[model samples]
Target: MSQLQVSASPHIHNGSSTPTIMRDVVIALVPAIIASGIIFGPRALLLIAVTVAACVISEYLSRKILKRSNSIRDLTAVITGILLALNLPVSLPLWMAALGGVIAIVIVKQFFGGIGQNFVNPAIAARIILLMSFASQMSDWVVPFEYSQRIDVTTTATYLSGAESSLPSLIDMFLGVRSGSLGETCGLALLLGGAYLIFRKVISPLIPTVFIGTVALLSFLLGGNPLYHVLAGGLLLGAIFMATDYTTSPVTRNGKIIFAVGCGVITVAIRFFAALPEGVSYAILLMNILVPLIENLTIPKTFGREVKQREN
Candidate 1:
């Protein structure tokens, strides 16, 4: 038999490690983090701190127990913490957020084979788990400080629906006004973060661009303004943060477009027809399960194979 060379892929490394990418994600999330803290008060920082600390600790302990070489230096735990914090309501108790972090890092992430091997997006899974476990606490939303000092908080469904009577101004919505989860409130910040990710080459534009466009087009056709749909709820957050998860998302360009479109369609369907107000999280999670199928269908054509076909 003729000798053939076979080895691992990704032969080219940009001098970037898993931890570097994770760290970039953390840096990208900062604008939103600061905006959230300003809008939601000091508790936002406290919640973020606890969640990050808990995730790191849980990851360390899990790796220790499993006797695996510790990879906590990868900053994945920090990313998970920030992501979990972004999905949480501003009023959630500190302990609950920490619990979510633990589930995200220890259970969903490490237990499933660490960063690249996890079957689902850990932060989204943790968010869903928290919602299931603490429905009331998870649904709590406080009005922005602009409204009052009393923090007249209310428990409502997620933000995809019009459950909240007082809609934030378009300007405020773009500026991270209104009230909801920490990173979720600021559409502008998410955009900035998304742009940063794009600039850093951490994520491709296909997923987020397609995801956002699908939702915008669909919503516009159904009588909603495109800009309004884009600015509302966690569309920005989920499209950029949750949908573009490296491990769970498609690797092929065509597959990414399909994944993004599927996310937008599911999100709109859930928002328009379903009882649940927010669908981005669920939509992304649903698409996460379809990545393999999408990649299979959208596999890139071999360059020389087409030449052979033409000759034939």
Candidate 2:
């Protein structure tokens, strides 16, 4: 007689793997990458190309020097490169952008034992490093298609250009016709990319939906425009991409909700009360540091298990 095999209940397994999900993420990022290039001109494209090449090359050399298995094929380095580029200004020096890529893929990402083992979001970590290293360069943004004999330092394009005004036009913001980060300006493009991710089932809506909804609701209550809130800065990018990092974010549904809500609260607080204009990066980075605690606090109840009360 043959013994029946017992499984851990997920019994259903598929051909889906880490590489598959990373590919889907890359596809989702294409629309925004192209939009940024079209809007910001060659500089944007140049930054993307340079950052990506730097990341891939850095990863290759780092692995070779360390005698580790080749990791550039996993596409994590590509995603990190793209994301880091999106977080940067078009006016940054190519060398600095390349440095950001090195920090992203090598220091923050690989030094800690590659993708899934990293404690923080690599792009955000690299961004923070760059921001701290070169504050002026990081803040310098140029208008879309602004190529001239003499470069100007004027702030020509910014979503928060007129904070004194009651509100900015939501339509303009959503249509990617505003001034901001290269890829973050186009709310519509980000949403389309996010929708693609959702359709591909690479990410759970629990995090993005709950996170964005919390920000929207709070901003509305604070007399801010809800749609504009969704369209501004890196909100969409953070909600859809950064907050959903498999290594740094929560795994279970409840943990995801809490982590996202925490992101929303911190983001709103920073936007409204803090000195910085936008808070998505800091918020996600902060929450990335909290994933373990969130997981411990919100683990799913097993079948026929009693709920444990919080000890206060």
Top candidate (TM-score):
2
TM-score of each: 0.90, 0.91
User: What is the lDDT for 144 in model 1?
Assistant: 72
lDDT of 2 by residue, 1-312 (tens): 999999796689877888788999999999999989887888898999999999999999988988899988888889999999999988889999999999998898779888688999999999889988897788787665564322444332234333536334777677776666788888888899999999988998899999999988988888776677778888999899889999999898889999999999998887766777678899999999999999999887689888899999
> What is the alpha-carbon lDDT for the whole of candidate 1?
0.84
* Pairs of residues at least 3 apart in sequence or in different chains that clash in candidate 2: none
Candidate 1 off by > 4 Å: 1-11, 146-166, 305-312
Give the alpha carbon lDDT tens digit for every residue of 248-281 in model 1. 9999888898999999999888878887757888
TM-score of 1: 0.90
Q: Cα lDDT of all candidates, in order? A: 0.84, 0.84
Segments of candidate 2 deviating more than 4 angstroms: 6-10, 149-168, 304-312
Residue pairs with clashing backbones, model 1: none
